[model samples]
Target: MARKAQTPDIGPFDRHSISLRVDHVRQLFQTLDPYPFTERDLDKDAEEFIVSWARELTGDGPIRIVIHLPAQEASSAEGRKLGNAVRRYFEERTRAVSLDLRECFRLGRLSLAIGASVLALCMLGAQALSQHSFPGSLQSFLTESLIILGWVANWRPMEILLYDWWPIARHRNLLRRLSVADVRIVAVSPDERSHPPH
Candidate 1:
């Protein structure tokens, strides 16, 4: 029986739940681009923050992420608008990453199927060639060559379906976790800052 190579366990990391205070939502959304609210601008800031945050993490289990924004709106109307904008930003970014992750999985599965098919065909050819009444030395050489090619063909699909996809799957889960994280709008008061860790 052939043994599969062991891969390191990359997992849902743990951390002392993190919190970031956004004193003013307007400051966070202000971008210097000449064109405001362009296609490129949507979710740009939020994704960047998430990616940078993901990089700093080092743990073995999941942790809570909290983003606290100012509860006191500049005005009631503006406050509502600002809150809506922030929520939409994270929602759009989450959708984009989720779609990409799904596509990656789909492509990996297709490649796996194709590679396995080719490997099987090559192996069958090797067996057929070995049984033919051709010159003995030439027949043996052809059989060896086919077997080698089959293994080569099998390599990528095996890696894609087995090894490569694991990390991507793990990353997708992390992104999802981050996206749906607790987003609280705290009033401009010191009492909001004091909370015991869970």
Candidate 2:
């Protein structure tokens, strides 16, 4: 299948708000050192910043920060002023990070349910085709193809669910562990071409 580039359905937020948030985050990140930050530092900094900034913006209640970053160069003094305002907002915020685990889990569960439904539909179609007195070879081919398609379809939703459950910090750790396991498996494989030399 030719994969179409999906235009993301951004919820509720307007371009201005998103731009503001991006500008804020960029300025916040700039306060830290270097690009391509490691997992540990990124996790720690993200948590600390989110918590502090949230508290400052919303004052001990649920808060969302909306930042705007213009695509064009900020040549005008007004643009620079707006950027500086975002920077100050981050600096003045509280220094705590908290995530609602329950909400994250709920989102994960919803994603899993959707993926399972898609897989279930694929299975049902295969079963229906099999019972229609089709030739044995054709039935087998259709069933196998449907199963493979279903598996591929489910992959992205499953990944999203996993990401929600793990969050950034935990996800990074999970990826590291998975990478190590992959390396070990490749090292132990006898066929260099089949498994490829690690």
Which candidate comes out best when scored by lDDT?
Answer: 1
Off by over 4 Å in 2: 1-106, 163-198
Root mean square deviation (Cα) for candidate 1: 10.8
Best TM-score among the predictions, by candidate number: 1
**Model 1 scores what on Cα lDDT?**
0.56
Task: Please provide TM-scores, in order, for all candidate models, with all chains considered together.
Answer: 0.60, 0.33
Considering only N, C-alpha and C atoms within 3 Å, which residue pairs clash in candidate 1? 13-61, 14-61
Q: What is the lDDT of residue 130 in candidate 1?
A: 70
Residue 67 local lDDT, model 2 = 27
Quote the positional error of residue 35 for candidate 1 in Å.
11
Candidate 1 similarity to native, TM-score: 0.60
Instruction: Report the Cα RMSD per candidate.
Output: 10.8, 22.1
Q: 1-198, model 1: which lDDT tens digit per residue?
A: 011111222233235244445555445564664444322243355556655665566753454444454456533454445444544555666677677767777877887788778878989999898778776588888888988887887787677767776766666666655545544333444464354222
lDDT scores of the candidates, listed in order: 0.56, 0.41
